[model samples]
Target: MSNEQVVNLNTKNKKINNRQLVKLSIFFTSVIAIMLIFLTNVYIVKEGEYKVVRQFGEVVRIDDQPGLKVKIPFIQSTTTLPKVKMTYDVTEEEINTKDKKRIIIDNYSVWQITDPKLMITNVRSVTGAESKMEEYIYSVVRSELGSLEYKEIVNDEKSSRGSLNEQVTLKVNELLQKNSIGITVLDVRMKRTDLPSENEQAVYTRMISERESKAQEYLSKGDASKNRIIAETDREVTELLAQAKADASVIRAEGEAEAASIYNQSFSKDPNFYSLYRTLESYKKTINDETVIMIPSTSSFAKYLQGNN
Candidate 1:
């Protein structure tokens, strides 16, 4: 090849190789772009989530099954929502009871998204759904609690709130369904209920007063019972004493009568000897150291002394 011919051929060959290199670079770049698109469009759907596919900001479909999933590149998008239950701690709010007493209630709910598409259409996000659901929950809870007295909500032992949580859950679910919020409440409960700071001391005072009143009532009843028992005991003692006195009088009279009878029988059995003994007793009484004998006593005593009775 001549020198000029060689220079022209080398330049042409160099242009040809440059074109091939450009084509190769273009091919590699296209492959890399395709790979990047694939990677960006792909997502993994886990067991406890729902992958919502949206096209141009509008929901197209929901993939709830677990594993690798894909969507159309640059035209579709995926958002994840929890398929499992979630707990929402509702903000504490004050509600007036039927008795017009105000109290604060803090609640929490266990909820789950059943339909991702419907949820997206309605609430657009988990936080939005919770916000709307919390409103309904507060409304229902207030309505239900407002129909009850303060004591019924605070006093667990005497509470008429047997199905209070259930009622709230049912009413909230009804509201959600009516509004088509696509979320279902599994359970709703009052995590805490408290008296307002301004009213707490007053409530405590009232409760203490009630307890004191009950104690006083019991003491009064006990005192009345004690008095009744004492009265009954006194009456029984009086009756016993009266019966004992009557029985003693009857025995004393019987003993006196028996003694009189015995004396009469003994005197009747020895009348002359008894007369002599009586005369001697009379003489003994009449003959003291400074004694002077009376006429009738002297006649009987002299006759007895002379053995002439």
Candidate 2:
């Protein structure tokens, strides 16, 4: 081999070596890129969550089971949704009833995402879903409250006013279900219901007035009853005293009649004896322990006392 041939061969060998190195680098880079894509597309569906796989802004698959999942790199994206129950506490709202009464109502609800696909399709994000829920709840609550009277809404009397809470919950659930917001309503409760400050003062005043009126009525009725009882007792006592006097008079008259009858019978039986008995009675009256007769002889008493005539 001459010197030029040696130089040309050396150059060709170097060019070949450079070409092989470039090929090896390209191969390794391609392999690494493929590996990175594969790693990036892989995801895991955690517990209490559901993953939605989207391709080009369209949902292509849903991973509901807890396991590892793979998708096309850079083309498919995954979104995780909470499968657990969520709670929301709505602020107090002022509402007017059919009876033109204003009241403040505070409420809360427990809900869960039932259909992740529907939730994602209808509402883009969890915050969006929450907003939609609040809107729906507000509308439903307002509508239901508008149909009730103030007494029915605030009264705890189940028999007289009925149960407004049950009706409200049922109506709200039906409305949510009809709208297809992919939410399951677990419970709806009214935390508080109160009258406005001005109205409360008015109610208190009215209540006090009613109580005073009732007290006055009771007092007047009691007085009337007492007077009636006293009058009746007086009438009864008068009647009793009159009857007693009439009974006494009748008894005295009967005794007098019996005594007169007895005296007449005795006089008719012995007129001579009765006369002798009268004369003896007169003699006894004229005589005394100390005999001091200062009578004439013509006098009947003096003759009787001297045992003459």
Q: How many residue pairs clash in all the candidates, one count each?
A: 0, 0
Model 1, span 1-309: residue lDDT tens: 899999999999999999999999999999999999999999999999998898999888889889998899889998888999999999999999999999999999999998777778888889989999999999999999999998888888977665999999999999999999999999998888898999989989999999999999999999999999999999999999999999999999999999989978998999988797787787777787887655564476667766776
TM-score per candidate, in order?
A: 0.74, 0.60
Among residues 3 or more apart in sequence or in different chains, the pairs in candidate 1 whose N, CA or C atoms overlap within 3 Å are none
Name the runs in model 2 displaced over 4 angstroms: 1-36, 158-162, 214-309
Runs of candidate 1 exceeding 4 Å displacement: 1-20, 235-309
Best by TM-score: 1
Relative to the true structure, candidate 2 reaches a TM of: 0.60
Please, what are the lDDT tens digits per residue for candidate 2 over residues 1-309?
999999999999999999999999999999999999888999999998989999999998888899889998889999888889888887778888778888888888787888877777777777777777777667777777788787676667732223555666677667667777777777777887888888999978988999999999999999999999999999999999999989989998998999989977997799866766777887688767996767788876556567775
Alpha-carbon RMSD to native, per candidate: 5.8, 9.1
